[model samples]
Target: MKKISEKIVRLRIVVIVLVFLITIGLGYFIPRLKVNPDVMSYLPKDDAVAMQFEDVGKRFGGNQTVIVGVKSDDIFTEKTLSLIRDITDSLRVTDGIRSVVSLTNIIDIREVDSVLTVSNLIDEYEIPSEPKDLDSIRQYTMSKDLYNGFIVSADSKMTMIAAKIEQEITETIDTNLTGKALMVYYADKYPGKMYEFEQDADTMKIKINKAAVADQIRDKLRTDFPDAELYFGGLSFMVQDIGDIIMHDIMLLGPIAFLFILMALYLGFRNFRGVFLPVLTVLIAIIWTLGLMAILGYEITLVSNVTPIILLAVGSAYTIHVVNRIGMEERNGGNYKENIVAALKYIIIPVFLAAVTTMIGFLSFIYGSYLTMIRDFGIFTAIGVVFSLILSLSFAPAVISYFPPKKRTKTEDKPEKGIIAAMLMFFYRLSVFRGKWVILAWIILAGVMTFGGFKLERRVDLLD
Candidate 1:
């Protein structure tokens, strides 16, 4: 051990350089990291929600939809009606929409020349170029019993131009659509292109929106037609907003947390090296782990985001404990070689136990029903735990030795007290109790907890 320290001291610069080179080399070979955007990926395949979503997606062809409602004070007025027509017309031409339903596309059964003629008011068979012709069509559109307020507002406050978006339509709307009514009109004309529709004389139903698709369309619409009152509803829209929120939080929270960790280290150790050295070690291990995941093609999901921070917090503890021991040893008159040995010997067993137990706590979660993300967390964190242990054992000792303090006369030992103290206090209190009484108390507590366990109720799925 003495010879090893002397040789390392002689090659201090080489060891430090090698550590940096190794970190950089490993990082380069590891691939860029990516995250799986779908939060559902972490859910178990056999889970009810997973099964339902899969079934709906396959059978009904995407239960997602994008609803566009146009509101005005008096939508039944000629001007507002014209606006509805214009909007519906624009939507009909929009790419990727499966179906569109508005007052414009509804059919009416009317007595024409004393005979009932069933035809769409806005039929492609006849093109009305003038207001008079449009008004004639409107008269028929209004008289029909089927043209209920479902397609229009009762008090004429608003009307809807809805689109059922296909999964492929998400790709198309992202690539091709333009105009405020692109979704509406697109669904109207190409209703059969990607998905089916349901009509209840007045109400229009189309396939749901896909998140990526809905968001692109929403952002473009919001930007280009800032004044347009757009009402977007559907599963796709919901997922799109969630994705945006995740990104926003990542941007806002990640850096602030890093700064907080740095501050914590600085407060604990009052020195530049004390604060940075340990942080650097954890960062290296995390980068290597994530890089390996990227190279191995594992997609990070929502749960994976928490692992890096957990690694940073827990991994730093081992380093700090070692550095604190080294600092204490230098203050108490011990040489670098002896202090390094003392710190490693003292911390190794305790830190190993802590790291192992913490890892077990994470690993136990693998027994959960839906554990894809948790599984990744367990594996990566276990790897980090190993790296932290290694660095604490080797690199930390080497670094501290390179900057060792002058030797002193006496080396005093610090006793481990917290847990031992609590145990002793508990034993002292229990000294008054008879052995039979203690056993009886334990039996009673166990019985009470067992009774409570049976009272636990299973949760219900509202959608189910």
Candidate 2:
């Protein structure tokens, strides 16, 4: 409560700066970061739904697949047929594959000594070397036993390369390595579906890993064949791809927003101290939030990526409001103490309201069904918002008090009103011209809206 002065203000700023440095340093040094990605981990394991989901993922092949489409003008041509042979051969040796199906994968029909035998043919053939033999290959491909339309086109122009991935691999594969490798390469891909056996409760149906692995292989092939057309589908690959898109957007969008916020703060205050001080506060808050996550063992996910940028954008408003007030008071012949006090008095309610509203907006996410990353986001951002509110109130006051801008006097000639004043005048004129008409228009619009709402019927079964 002592008279606001330069020394008192500077002392306050020193305290804030010290706290920021300590928090940031502690954040960097703390160790612990856990990423529990399994959605089931958050749910009570004993719950029936959770158990059923786990069983489905395990017994039903875990939603992974690799699909290879072999396309050729003449799929039966010996060259393209041989290519299919080579690709199947490559897949069999690949690790973590549970099952593979193709034209060559089914039984091979052979006749010897007037008797016919149906045996696995994929193991019998070397890569067919002659283009002339494509006719015979086509005949063999069409035989009822080798491949139905499921693996080869009816006209023998295309064939499918399908594989089921092991569940254990889906559970434990290195995400960064596989995701990067697959997204970088791949041609037309389709994910396989899951079907359940009619009679067996424990038995599940379908393939896995084919799509994820195929995308990687396809991306690699792009280096040699730039025009390759690849399409990928399947529940597993779609999920992984969605996760990737989210990560990619965050990586690109967050920094750009932060830089824009810094620029806005500079333009609003027109002072180097005004820009740097709040920026430092924002940075410290960010590092502290993230550091706390790391210390508490949280992984950065799609939802948590925007927390820092949001803090920067929303938190800067406090500093901007305070400095604008200080600048206005200085121009009106007030001493530093009077200016700082007046600024604080004007902004305290607005700043507190903004912080509470922002915190509430984020808190709403805590009730969402997806809790793993989104919950973490809610908790972390809430902490940052609170810190932002406190710093905005404390740091701005201290900085203004310590610096104690040069005193103004009534005898001096006042500087001309600036662009802000001009803009306000223009807005005032616009209000005078349009105010009554705007109100009348809004009333009419509201009446229409109300009538429309009354006429509309609610449909509870719309989801069906």
Give lDDT per model, in order: 0.65, 0.63
Expressed as tens digits, the lDDT of each residue in 1-464 for candidate 1 is 44554555556567777777867876885555754444544567878887787677657645556666778875555555666666666555554555667766766566789999997666543455567766565565456546546666555576777766554322234333345465566567655433434443333354433555566556655665566566766555665665566666555666676788899888666677678778877787777677767777776555666667777888878888877877776665646667677666676677778878877777776676365777877777787777776676567777877676644433324432565557766786786666678888899999999999999998733222
lDDT digits (tens) for residues 127-177 of candidate 2: 465655556666766775447586787887778877666654222223343
- Model 1 lDDT, full chain set: 0.65
Question: Which candidate should be chosen as best, given lDDT against the real structure?
Answer: 1
lDDT of 2 at 21: 80
Q: Which residue runs does candidate 2 get wrong by more than 4 Å?
A: 1-14, 26-51, 92-96, 106-124, 127-150, 153-158, 169-244, 329-342, 368-371, 399-402, 406-422, 432-436, 439-464
- Candidate 1 TM-score to native: 0.64
